[model samples]
Target: MIFPDNRYRQLRAIQAEDFHTCFYCGCIATEFDFAPPKAHWQSYQYRQLSADNLQVPACKECVALLKPCTMGLVQQRREWVHTKIAAKYKKAIGVYLKWNEDELEELDFSLHHSIAAGLKLGEESHRRSNFQGFSHEIDGSKVADVLPAAMPIVLFDKQFDSLKDAILYVCKNYPITQPKLVERLAEQGNNIEAVVMEIQEEQEVAQFQRQLKIQSAAFAKKHNQSARFVSNEVERYLDKELAYSIAEALDLLYEERVKHYR
Candidate 1:
């Protein structure tokens, strides 16, 4: 696991607070990240950049997030990592930005817990992303915030604190179940109204199928034909003609086939 000294940056903490703290997110550092990374250091052009070859303390999560980054400058690399952190917790950030402590207090236990968890995550991520570098005591200099602004979740011309809230609201208003809605949303993308319509159409088709089976069984019993035979014929006719209803298909089957037999 040892890296070459010239190739890998030397570990250094600029300030006392920087020790054991993630340079990217301010979390407790469990690992070290090589600024410009070892791979980038291989390039002669990249090595020529006035990049500080410093190994900085980073949490496991930040290390993983920076795996693909090749920025040579430490500041640029830090900003890149912050961007990833913001994107990674965008939903949580939305929740944090949308609701305050007072609003969270009004929610029921389950909902309150759900939102509270999201808010906590959002707060941590928010802090980590905005975290300025450790203060420099020389003249008491401070760093500017690095976190990007977050956008709230919006649906049906309404804004939601989080995606979970939006999904809950949709489930309440629509006949679609939450699980099915979530499943379809993953398959169909974020068009909530379209997803609702798709589920409704599926329900209608399923209901019509059940009705057809029941009514066709009754028709089969009355006409002395096998239930499967009647159902199959009716379905075939309906498939041939999109406008044909089950009742119409059954009547046509009786007229065309049953009349000849009886």
Candidate 2:
């Protein structure tokens, strides 16, 4: 089953300047080359991708990689448009730093805020009413003693992909000490320099160890031999980029051993 999202639909005619090919497939796609999803992902499989924070791309084919299914080129093509938009906003923020208050307001912050918030949540679940008197707080404690004038308004699609992209954009483009902008946003109790979210580490090891113990105990009762196991928790501490590199190494080693046996 495939579900279309509205933010995907509204993203019909956008692209990043340097974005000449797909990130995964490396296919050349133009702004007109893609069409937006005409609702939302309503199936059981995509629910995990949405709520549980999977890093799967929003293509029909990518969704199908969930072990029991597959998605078509149409689905994959549909999602690159969004990547294009995210890339654009990143560029836009860089451009904004060149302008003053009057010039910045003319860029239409209200419309962008609406679009960004919708992408972060979803169409049906997203509400303008939800943003009333809302503000973003900067936690200087986590990063450095760096004083940011305000928090950047970053929109995350999944727990990792979109959020990381936004962070990279800020770090590459608008990273500076804008005291005036910071002070003004602080006065209003809302910052607009970066998006901040609460990050909680999952106690995966403890949970895994507890489950392993139960399984081992059951096995011992049947055959009186200890069940050996390995921990997969190394993924939690490594950054997503590094985790991929590590997974690749393990996967290649497994393949090599299989080839040697053959």
> Among these predicted structures, which one has the highest lDDT?
1
Candidate 1 residues lying further than 4 Å off, grouped into runs, are 1-60, 71-161, 176-197
Best by TM-score: 1
Model 2 lDDT, full chain set: 0.32
Clashing pairs in 1: none
Residue-level lDDT tens digits of model 2 in 1-262: 4343323321121234314332222233222222212122334235533221112222332222222222223334334433443333443433333222333445477865644543343421112111111111112112222223223344443232222234444334543333333333335433233222211112344564476456445543544333341113223323335544433533443354323653
Candidate 1 Cα lDDT to native? 0.75
Error of 2 at 190 (Å): 15
lDDT tens digits, residue span 128-215, model 1 = 8867655322122333323343356677578876555777788778786665666676577556667867777988999988998899
Error of 1 at 128 (Å): 8.8
Candidate 2, superposed: residue stretches over 4 Å from native: 1-75, 97-262
